[model samples]
Target: MRRILIVGAGQAGLQLALGLQAQDYDVTVMSNRTADEIRGGRVMSTQCMFDQALQHERDTQINFWESQAPRVQGLGVSVAAPDGSRAIDWLGHLDHYAQSVDQRLKMAGWLETFAQRGGQLVVHGAAVSDLDFFARTYDLVLVAAGKGELVSMFARDAERSPYDAPQRALAVAYVHGLGPRPEHPDTEAVRCNLVPGVGELFVIPCLTTSGRCDTLFWEGVPGGPLDVFRDIKDPAEHLATTLELMEKFLPWEYARATKVELTDAGGTLAGRYAPTVRKPVGRLPGGGAVLGVADVVVANDPITGQGSNSASKCAAAYLAAILEHGDRPFDEAWMQATFDRYWETARHVTTWTNAMLAPPPEHVVNMLGAAGELQPVADRFANGFNNPADFEEWFYDPAKTEAYLASVTG
Candidate 1:
């Protein structure tokens, strides 16, 4: 059996390790935190997996929260005026629903599951020097660490990475007792409120460490009204600040969240990191090359919520490449080729996500206006969040968006 050492027991690392282990490969996963620690720790992300990503997990038999997690059936989009009144509001129904399981619950469960499946688990942080040591033993070493020192080993790909700094100051809180949209009380949808130059707010229903709860994810433009969670350490204080911000910028959401309370002491997180794409192959000190996976290779801001989905697809692509190599060397060329295969899909997500971070283009603004009047246009836009590749056909380009809008409206 070919031996593999996967650094970082995240969605990508754990999934790939488990998948390879099931195929009888000698897989070992390294994690900084143990399963119990992760289960008891703070929330990691607002991970809402759409149909495609969820299906990938199901295909690998690792989707454990489908029955327990809340089902997000569609997307409710609203553009808020500077004064906090809704400018344009519409509901886009999805053909297939999406689901968000808190990473604290998901990752911890997956880490334990990987061990149960006979994969070795290393409970320690691995550095570049550590990778050099691991390189000698494993046939291949994959760096799936989402952030920190290990990821810096891979040089940024200047040509592919567009941003030089963090696009938005991100803050998130998982709370219980967030009321549903008044218009759609029975429906569970990702309610996205865009504040134009200010930033965006996403109210997502998710399965938290405790139980089902709502995640209020704020993407605040630098120095914007929503950028207020930097110094708050206490969860209750964070929730209060978030509520205050919402009341000022998104009164509708504030009204819905009036009865909100933190799910736990560790329910809030706030930080900022630039979105970047890095070289797929990172070099070790002694001439060994380690392959980068998931966020380590292509880290995007949570603005589009594509992080977990992209990681899932990346694992699937890399798994296919490894299975196809069939005793061949895991060389630089193979690593590059595998990343390119995944990039074909990921590029759309990156492009779409980057586009979302900027001010809406004229055509996009027009499309949003049209969506309020047309259900098909709204549904297409809503579903685009599920499969970003669809955006290439009608969203990114002005001509395509206009033509698509005309066809739908007519």
Candidate 2:
């Protein structure tokens, strides 16, 4: 049994750990917080797992919340006009459903699962110095902690990373009593409202520690009017401010959010990070080599909600890479090749997501508008959430978009 140490207990780390445990490899995970501490903590992210990613969890038998979580069946996008009315509005159907389960519920539950099943769980914050020591005992070490001092060990891959600073000021609140979209009275969907200059608003239905709820999130363009959540520490004030913004910029959404209340005192999250891609291997001061996983290596802005999805896929891809190596030394060459396998898919996600951060080019804008008139186009756009690679075929190029539109319209 080869011993492995994972320095983070997030989706990628935990999933990979559990998968290795089942295969009878000696596995250990280090988490900064215990399961109970995590359960009692604040919301972490605005994450929604689409079909492809969810299937990976199901394959590993780690999708314990499947029956309890709401199945978000589609995505509804509305571009706000100058007066806050919808300039173009349509709901695109996903071939299969997606879901959002709060990390407070998921990471905590997964932590417990990893421990309950005889995998070693270390409750401590791991730094590079810690890994320098642990590397002597474990045959392999992977860092999945996306944020922390540990991330600095993995240098940024300048060629792959474009932004040096954050593009959006993010704010999120989980609440109960958010009414359904009246237009799609029976649909369980994610709503994305795009405000050209200010930012974007997304309403995600999710299952949390409390039960099913909605996550009202904002991605404000940096230094823009909506970039205003940094100073408000009070959860009530945070929510109130969220509602006020909705009323002003997305009136229709505000109409339904009028009576909502926080799911708990810790149901709000506010912060920002630049989308970055880092080298796969982290080198310790003591000459120990460590591998970086998921957001630690390839952090997308979450503008397209790919954080959790990408993490799950990364774990799966790495699991396959490890299982195939069959006792090969986990060296720098192995780590880079492992990441290269995951990047085959992650590259598409990074490309599509990065493009969304900029104002859409005329061709992209035309395609979005066309979705309103073409059901097939809307369906393709919505389904792209599951596989962003599809966008490359028709979404990025002017000539491709023009040809695809002509083929569809006729």
Candidate 3:
């Protein structure tokens, strides 16, 4: 059995470790935190997994929270006017529901499951110096840690990475007492409110360690009025600031969240990072190289909620490539080829996310306007969040969007 070592027990690392172990390959996973620590730690992200990504988990038998988590059946978008009034309001239905299980719950549960499956689980803070030693022992080493000094091991691919600075100053608070949407109380959906030149706010239903709750996420344009959470350390303060911001930019959502309070002391997180794509191969001290996976290689801004979904897809894609390689050596060529396969899917996500970070192009604005009047257009746009590849057909190009709109309207 060829030994494989995966560093970082995140969505990508754990998924790959488990998949390889299931195939009877020798696998070991290293994580900075233990399951207990993760369960008791601060919330990591607002990860909403769409239909196809959820199916990937089910196929791998890792869909532990599917039965308990809230189901997001569609998408609700409201673009706020300069005066804070709703300019365009629409709800797009999705054919299949998406789900968000807090990373604390999901990652902790997955760590336990990986160990139970006979895969080695090592809990420790791994750095570049550590990778030098690990590279000598394992047949292949994959670094999947999304952040920190470890990620610096891989050089940034300047041509592929579009941004040098952070796109949004992000703040997230998970809270209780968030009332349902008035129009669709029974159907849970990911609600997004866009305040052009200010920021975007997302209200996502999710299952946290404290049970079901809603996550209030802010993606503020840097130095803008919405960028107001730099000094907030208390969860209560975070919740309060969130409500205050909502009241200013998304009053409808603020009204719905009037009774909201933090779910727990650790339910809030605030930070920022540049959306980057790094070379998939990381060179060790002497001469050895390790492969990068998921966020470690392609970290995108959370504007589109594609991080976890992309991680899930990357895990499945890498698993297939590994299995197909059979007894072949895991060489530099193989590593590049594996990442190239995953990049085909990731490029779509990166492109879509980057498009969303900027001001809406005229065609996109037209599309949103049409969506308010056309149910099919709304539904297709809503479903596009699940399978972003569908976007390439009509989203990126103004001419294609115009042609599609004409065909549908006629």
Candidate 4:
């Protein structure tokens, strides 16, 4: 069996290991956190798992719903502006899929499957020194670490994807007692607002076992009326300010919200940006090479909620490449080819999504206003990430944008 070491224990690392292990690769995963530490916390962000990716999980017997996950119909997405709203309901029947899992539960589940198959797990602090040693010892080393100190070793200065410009800042928080929309309390959906020049805010629902749902969220385009109170020391005042801003700048539909309960204020309010870079391939200072996958290579802005979908697609491609090389000396050409295919497939989705979030270049803004036709275009781009067939069609067609615009306007 080909021996491989995957660094980072998050979704990408776990998925990659699971895929490779099915082919009997001697896979070992190394990470700093333990199952207990990971599971004890609420997931930090809201994410979605598409039906296609879930199907892959079931095929690999990594399906979590059969064991610990909740299978639900798709989710709803609402786009709101300062004056009002536009909702694209996804509440009806659809193929089976899962929403965000407790990060800890997700970690625990993947780790269990990985170990059961006889793949080794190493829990330890990581450094360049450790990665360097592994590069020499293993036939293949996969770096799946997302943004953090650990990812710096493989980082490079690539250009900003045309669809996206320089990155913007965002603040994410989790809140409780955020009483649901009075009309539809049972729905699991995400509410988004293009708060004019202030960026966007995402309000998503996360269900807990106690029957109380937590509000998973994001505050984008910092430095506005909302930005003023972010560092405020008083919880009551901070929440009051948030509510006020919501009322003033968001649609009146959110005004019905009567209460806001806060929790885990002790947690962080970290920020992230776009226009990130990753090299085509990374080489260790001393000698060997490791393939950089997912966000480690290209970190897209989370505004579109495409991270997990992108990661899963990349994992699937990586698995195919490894399988084709079966038992041969690790083929460098095959690895690069696989990486290139993944990049080409992802480029448009990542670029267009980022472009929407970026302060629109002047020409783009004029074009959008001239047509009064940007929203539907933006919505289609966000929703299209999961359909591989559509993605393939999109990348091959240079005039897809013009075609889409003409169709929408017509």
Report backbone clashes per prediction. 0, 0, 0, 3
- Give the Cα error of residue 73 in candidate 1, in Å: 0.5
Candidate 1 pairs with clashing backbones: none
Give me the displacement of residue 369 in model 2, in angstroms: 0.8
RMSD of each: 0.9, 0.7, 0.9, 4.8
Q: Is candidate 1 or candidate 2 better by lDDT?
A: 2
- Which RMSD does model 1 reach against the true structure? 0.9
Model 3 error, position 327 (Å): 1.9
TM-score against native, each model:
0.99, 0.99, 0.99, 0.79
lDDT of each: 0.90, 0.94, 0.92, 0.61
Question: By TM-score, how accurate is candidate 4?
Answer: 0.79
What is the clash count of model 3? Answer: 0
Off by over 4 Å in 4: 66-98, 155-157, 160-166, 176-187, 207-214, 226-244, 251-253, 260-269, 359-382, 388-410
lDDT of 3: 0.92
Write one digit per residue (lDDT tens) for candidate 1, span 1-410. Answer: 89999999888988898889879999999999999999999888888888898888998998899999998999988999866689999999998999999888888999999898888999998888888888988899999997888887899999989998998999999999998888999999998999888888999999987899999999999787777788888888888888888898899999989898899988999999889999999999988999999999999999888889999999998999999999988999999999999999999999999899989989999999889999999999889888998999998789999899878867
Q: Candidate 1 — number of clashing residue pairs?
A: 0
- State how far residue 376 of model 1 sits from its true place (Å): 0.5
Specify the highest-TM-score model's number. Answer: 2
| TM-score for candidate 3 | 0.99
Give, for candidate 2, the lowest lDDT window spanning 10 residues. Answer: 323-332
What's the residue-level lDDT of 29 in candidate 2?
95
